[model samples]
Target: NTQVNLGGGEGLAFRNIELGTGLTEFESPEVISLLDASQFRLLNLDEKTSILLTGGAGSGKTTVAIHRICKLCFNKHVLPQDILILVPHHGLVLLSRKILNSIGLDQIKVMTSREWFRNQSLRLLKGIGKEVCQDTPFRVSLLKRHRNMMKVINAYLDTKKLEIVERLKRSAFDDKKIVQFMKETAIIKWMKEIMKGDLSVVQKMLLEQLVEELNDYNAIREEIFKDRKLLKNIMDDQSELITSNVIEETIKHTHKQFLEEFQEEDSREHTLDQKNISFRTPDDVSGTIDLEDYPIMLIISNALNGGTINNGETLKKYRHIVIDEAQEISPMEMMVFGHIIDQERGSFTVAGDLAQKVDPISGFTSWEDALVDLNLSQDLTELKTLEIAYRSPQKIIDLAHHVLGPLAPKRIPISKKHHGGVLRTIGEHEAHILILINERLEKLMEQEPKSSTVIICSSLDSARRYREGLRNLANVRLVEEANFTFKPGVDITTLEQVKGLEFDYVIIPDLDFRNYPVNDYSRRRLHLAMTRAIYQLWILSPSAFSPLIPNE
Candidate 1:
């Protein structure tokens, strides 16, 4: 028993709660005595079944998941190479690979969802890539084949439309064509940007029309105007009809859609040549997949491909799959995972904490909904949840929940007393924060020179700008999508980019309210940023982050 100060000058008595009924310790790192019985049971789940392991920030769900891999590799004699460990970001891949390697389970395939799909799509089509840059050319091939279309793309675009409509008003450009193009720009996005497809029958007609015109612009314009009835029917729903004589001026962004769809039925000569694939533009409805999000389209394309490469030198269908950071994947992506697992009809494991989900793009709502979406509810033996945090300091977890506010679920803290964190408001006019950071960083480094630390920013651009003054420090690097190398020094990074990473000390600077508002996404992101600190945390802001969770 211990005496606790109640902060209001009251004293209360309490005692530490032990984990399980027995005090015996197990020899394996995974089987430590302190581990909650629930976590141990999760590690020993049936190898032939799928699993979903969820927990709060420091609940050791990751630790349990890694242990399960060890169990599969050694106890079940599963080959390391056969295990497909899919993760949300590259950092997680690096971290998972290290943990797996420590258990002598080398050659496990660690990949982002994109890399996995790319390998899958490549094996199905033997080098039949888009001479046109594929957003994976397999995607272009899929589009031309009419297997992946409106339904999947529309679902993906609709979410984006919701986000964009909230951020932007209807555009003010005067030209009707420009307005139409802008509307389409926000809808279908740039499919033409990466797609190099074989010409459709209509594009051939447009090409011939362009070739035969003697007076160049005027002649082509006249020919197009002459066929207003036919062209109008072709572009019936579009606001901009082909009436303008200034063809070049009018055809700017909208022409690609028009030309891609405009092919003659008789002109499109089909041949037995296996390589010659013809592409036709479907009359686009409200939306289609944006090139910016390639994975969404791949989900649709893979669905079209029916879970296997139908052709030569195909990659083996993975019977054992493991997905990490499951909360970061959207509902549609859950469908993709469902399709793969169902096709192989094999068991897999997925682990994540809903509280730590910070990705704005993620469509996860609740654990029940996630299971239903993935069609795993009935098959799931039980939903195992880890409540005790083994990593985060109590102070940090308390702060995280405070930020999450009244609705967030409570978590048990297993760590001893936490101290050495600083949450201060550094006014814009106050002494240069950079100098203070530089001095503090030097002190931390001198004590633990080999330890890792990171200076957290709200965005990559902010991190890029903030790191300019910190370059004088040793091994201080900026973590971005293209450049991420975690070393024994400070790293400048943003919330989303730094997922599945930890540092001995974490510094969160530049906490401007404009950048981080009192919103769900922002709070979740801040919560994640807070939990990254394995030891100490420092919150340096221009002002208080949110009124709900003051740092005092």
Candidate 2:
């Protein structure tokens, strides 16, 4: 066996170390093959022990994950409600649910982390017999600035009498305040603006665009805040994860905040008193809970503070957890989960590849470190790696390994016989590319009755351009990140949206260097897209090739 690198181009690797054996007691009822012994062994892992499953592209990591989940619930008799399957995005949530439902394993809970976090916040509000409103007593006014988001609060504070500003000066918030600020990435406000020099072209455009969005939402936000009754029912809302406070703070960080100009039924101007405006900006004059009220806060507040609520029933604490795409999980999120997950049971399985981290700034370095942050120690935790490249052919796998550069994991190839797919460069314009894509679609359709094809573009905007011209081609539709259904047809989407998804045949149009340049992130995106094809992959670009993909 050839040794592979683990941390990118460092040329480092460890000896082959096998863990526990595959399960012998349990058997799945589904029609499948136990062809991969390692996968079988991973499924048989001791349920009581926490596990970290790390592997390379095309390895049967997801295959083993779903199978183990079924084995626990269907065969092991674990209560369905006690199991939680967390995915990175909504599309994966749909995919996981479909996988379960196909195996007749309903009742299992599947949700994105953001959805889970939002639900937790909703529970807290319901328990207190309150609601989450944009503004309970009206958010007062909106402020727009370029860099200093906290400036709005400061500006509001400045308008206040000198005595009030003095009281808040240099006042330090609690630990959670710091934690929340970090989570929002709003520290940039207090940190020196890139003002070390003029803003870069990208930075300047991004900040200005943010201001435009803030201005656009002004009227909608104002109308939402005008409902005093809704505002009165509000307790704590989301700060970063879809809570009222989170949006307010984000808009603050961008330095472009806005509120609607409230109008009475009689067409008269409506405004808060001058003193009240000051109170609302920096203080909670409406008594609505600040978004700083997070799920962990609720856990501590309810259990420790002996808080009560009229939510009728309590939110469930999952006894077993399955985190899919665990590589994308941030350090802050892991810290939060460290608190909520049941420590006594400790039946957790996190699945992800460190190398497959397509996006930078993920705050993910290593599973060993995440284990410590997650409070899972070597004494109780076991590791699993499915090094098989089951999804791609030898050519595709080789291309991917090369593109991964130095940070690729020490992946072992287990897939040898299942080879099918073509990776080629078509020198053609968008019009020619569309013709070729349609031709491939016709071939796939003739081969199978209900075949699903996905033509992934560089971005949503690019996808729309393709979609607008080829709308009549085989049930064509744009796939949004929130899309929960997988119909038998063509789907055009972005690189970010297609994670944890596969297709019968895949087409990557607009594969030029201008769109997908030669870089770590773009290369990972290309690698990710390449691996999604179960049977076929066709790359179309105006140029004869892409630097991201080497000439074979």
Candidate 2: the clashing residue pairs are 8-406, 8-407, 9-406, 22-41, 131-233, 136-231, 145-255, 222-260, 238-243, 239-246
lDDT of 1 by residue, 1-552 (tens): 011111110000000111111111212122245577777787777776678778777566666667777787778556676678888787777666666666577688888875665455444432222122223233222222121222434443344445434333332223543344345532222222212445555543433432232113222222332332323222223213222332233233223323444444445556777343456334321112222233443453343233332332324555567878887765655665666553434567878877777754354556676676566755654577777765556777788777777546765444533533434546452136677777767776776566677788877877887688787888788878624554566778888776766666677777667777878877888888888766566777665455645746
- TM-score, predicted candidate 1 vs. hidden true structure: 0.64
Query: Lowest-lDDT window of 10 residues in candidate 2?
Result: 8-17
lDDT of 2 at 527: 78
lDDT string, candidate 2, 1-552, tens digits: 111111110100000111111211222222126336656776776677777887766566666767677777766646777788888888888777776777677788899875676676565433321223344222222111111122322332223223322322323323543344334322223212332446555544544443233222223233233333233222233112224563455334322222233222245434664232222353322323222223323433233212332223345566678887887765545655665566776478888877678745444657886787677887887787776665555665666677676656566355442445555656457787776666656555555535566788888888888787677666777876649357666788887887877665567888788987877778788878876765566777866566776766
| Cα error of candidate 1 at position 452, Å | 1.3
lDDT of 2 at 12: 8
Can you give the TM-score per candidate against the true fold?
0.64, 0.65
Candidate 2 versus the native: TM-score? Answer: 0.65
